[model samples]
Target chain A: MTERLNEDQPIFIQIAELIETSIVEGDRLANEQVPSTNEFAKHYQINPATAAKGINLLVDQGILFKKRGVGMFVTEDAKQIILAKRQERFYTHYVQPLLQEAKRISLTQEQLLDFIKEGFSHED
Target chain B: MKISATDLNKIYKKEQALNHLSLTLEGNKIIGLLGKNGAGKTTLMRLIAGHFQPTSGQLEINGQSPFNHYSITRDVCLIQENYNFYEKFTIDDILKISAVFYPNWNASEAEELVTLFKLKRKRKISALSKGMLSAVGIIVGLASHSPITIFDEPYIGLDASYRSTFYDLLLQSYQEDPRLIILSTHLIDEVSKLFEEVAILHDGKLLLHEKAEDLAENHCIVSGPVKEVDKAIEGKQVLHQSTLLGQKTAILYDQEIDGNYDSLTFSKASIQELFVYLTKEEVVKHGDRN
Candidate 1:
């Protein structure tokens, strides 16, 4: 479950998010091997070094553990840990901005409802 | 372990291809060599690879000359866009030749790539398509495991999916063995991400040689108001400034961008946009005595 990222944050951060999302979504389970840095680089069409940096971020965070001769594997509690972390980030990073912008535009509950209704009417 | 070229000069028919350009190409990185058709990119790569004798300059490969020397040539494989192969030789023949040339040649790896690329081993060199030819070139360049692999133009007649596969393969190979890779191509945006360091050549001169991310970070388009942008870029390295309908976008060169300018915010410059801006004709150099 590779995550789709915007061109905003540095790519390595998005790569970490990608692995975390995979674990939380059950796409990547505990003890499963993750793609190597070069694999990720080729898959994402990014620099191999940048890919390694992204994977290393997860390793440093304890969400992933390297097996030396083997490959990188997800930690046991990676799913739950990522879920809680992402949930908090979602609200503060994404939700708050929408609420603040809506408030700034002076859109009340009723007005927003009416606006939605008008948009729906024009679509069909 | 960076590949550094000092006072690189190439003179051909009274026209200097490389005008004493000096650049320190970083190691363990993919560098995007961006330039026009006649720019000194090919010349620079050839000079570094020892394809031709330099008029008066020095190129050290990890501090060595790769020209006409088997020792350096074994560790450095240079592939140009139009590769010259024996027309009668098949893919197997090519592999045999590679075995004699590249000491790090992995036969199994070559076989695996042949299957991955769907290239037939029995096909003649003259009969291969442009895409297939490029694929063979990629296989050789990747499997050579050279310390420095310079690809003049890796993508020729390759479809989108094939090109994507090429990028993936290049990255996958580099992770196992980090080496200096230089790619000269007109398709700047497609391969810009793989570039750790980027060199912009214009009219036989090395215009810019900076880290890929740093190059993007160092310059930005500031557009809002003529007076506002002018004041915003005060004491900054203004690369180029243009006005439209009383609004001006001054392309400023700065190192650190906090991105909280009151008049206008700064966005990262795309490698392609920066190359165009840096190499545009009539644009004065940093300090032109004339």
Candidate 2:
């Protein structure tokens, strides 16, 4: 289920990220018809123009394509494109923050690496 | 339609309702008219709807005064919280009357909304529950399709599910017919995302009118060591601050937010939080003057 928007960022950017997550999670497959802006606006209780802007951002990124008079669809390589994009942002979005948080708690790099190895060895 | 209010002032007996309020808006966009109770939101909407004239200022819709102007008034619609209807009138009667008054009224849309709200045509206005009455107002507001539509606390008794439904329908209606829509309500957090821009009122005066996203991006709350937080926000406009056990948190409204805070954690300020801080600032300043 889609959660209500948070105050951290603009709704349009969040909408774009929501769609990207759907693609990356295999919920929205490549070449599949994605929800239209109207559908998104109604579902999210947001302005239609804002939803359109989010879709347009994805279209500009070649992850989604608009079929005139029909609706938007994920590109054939949408999942791959999203994966690559997220990989490029991993350091800034997750890894750097993780390391900083570790440093704040006085956890060294070697200790963090060991923890990661232990977690991988024992799956919940 | 272009709606312009210049140096608008409204006085109710000895009380000043609106004080030199000036605003100029054109094009079609959703504007969140937000303020505390008795902050002159109703007065402003009434003036725009021509229900009441400004005591000393000019209010025009499409370059013509709305007061006593049949065409201009017809183009504007203001749905107030307390909807006054003939007590004997049924839901169907109300919709029929509205269809005759509003030039852009959509009968099919009204019928659809009535069904969606589970409103029975034979039910009298006086007998409906508060939520049902609010639903009636929502139906009229959405189906009217006026050039300028203002809703003043239109969802007083609506449930959360119904409120969300209303928001969805509002967006769909707006997309179908682009118009200047102003919503005045205290449910800022719930409806903030739906607004393109917001106009904040405080003490009967316009405090701020800006893009919703831009305002959120510029304002933030930072918490960290007192010295580090103060040093990071030096020379910036701070709205509020608190200190506890050598830790401090400050709300800052700076357009050029320097995200280089090495020792502090920052988060964007919610619209509701900004509204509270801004409105409270006025009270503090007023108390100081007294």
Candidate 3:
């Protein structure tokens, strides 16, 4: 986790995405208390404010909620919310680019579909 | 604590160390003060720490001048790379003395750090290795708990592992007690992520002062065929450009990168890359005249 952050985007956004990934993978269940901002800062060697900003972004989006002074907790529907969000962006983030690259290589739609099916079989 | 410098200028003899610099920093933040050699990062920090009076302009900490002002100076600790201590004093003696000067200093924390850094209490300051001396400075800076702590290349001779430990300790202490921290180091890549704000100086002048996140977001590198790259960077501020055969790569600043240019590839320029390109551009411009 400490080595995952990169300069490709804002660190805060990456931090947020890491938490979201955990929630989506069910490693963090609903109402589970997340690590405090200070813990994240120390573990990641990042500024506490940057860690707070990332956590606050999740809170603002209803993916996490604060419990006064206790700490932040994963929302009950965090996985659903994250899945919906990613689904909405799937076309632009994944499908559109995949399609563009396929078109660039002159791969027909049928060939692309066949390739994707092969990819799924390999994954299993 | 809030520090505001308006049109600050510092001159040593005929050399201008800082020139017409204005900046404001407030609240709890870890700000990275970045610049090349002799770019006046130390001069600006010294002015803020009340070591030297600015040749001209106002430098105020919480609306009060820091020069010879004990009230402000007590709250600010400026630890330089080559810090000098009484050669006769032991490591414990130095820590005790610092605890007296910095009212907010935590003795227990200092002791823990001393042990962590593996410094002998009875060892005199004059007998320590360069890396050990840097560790002592790190201990003092972290345990001082000053509102405005400034570290100018605080770890000069420390090894890679020690440097990593220093960073971890710095973050841990800052998280325990939030304060305004200004860190100036040439090793920017190792610590760039720890900065909330970044203030870059080039030849005694303020180049840019902005949020670290925004700095990473606003700058990028675009690469492709020379003609495509040229067309993509038209009317944009290109900080640096290089060409190999027909392939061209240019670093763009504060430019909206259009993804519609399918032939071109875009990648975010890291802060260290941006700093190098930005300052190197000035040097190149200066060399052209000579």
Count of clashing residue pairs in every prediction: 1, 0, 0
Clashes of 2: 0
List, residue by residue over B110-219, the lDDT tens digit for candidate 3.
98988898889999989999998899888888899999999999998999999999889889888889899999999999999899999999989899999998897788
- State which candidate, 1 or 2, has the greater TM-score: 2
**Please, what are the lDDT tens digits per residue for candidate 2 over residues B1-290?**
99898998999767898999898767798899999988888998998888877899888888888888888999888898876567799999999999999999999999999999999999999999999999999999999999998899999899999999998888888988989999999999899878888899887888998887778777878898999998887888889999999999999886445657766787777788899898873446545775
Under CAPRI classification, how is model 2 graded? medium
Score residue A74 of candidate 2 by CA lDDT: 95
CA-RMSD of model 1: 5.5
What lDDT does each candidate get? Answer: 0.79, 0.87, 0.90
Per-residue lDDT over B1-290 for candidate 1, one digit per residue giving the tens place of the 0 to 100 score: 55678887889767888888888886777888899888888888887777887787787776777688877767778878866578889988998899888888878889999999999999998999999888888888888887888888976988889888888778777777788888889988788888878888888778888876567556677787788777777777777888999888877776444445554645556677777777777848777946
Mark the 10 consecutive residues where model 3 chain B has the least summed lDDT.
Answer: B281-290
Candidate 2 regions with alpha-carbon error over 4 angstroms: A1-4, A29-31, A75-85, A121-124, B281-290
Residue A73 Cα positional deviation in candidate 3, in Å, after optimal superposition: 1.8
DockQ of 2: 0.63
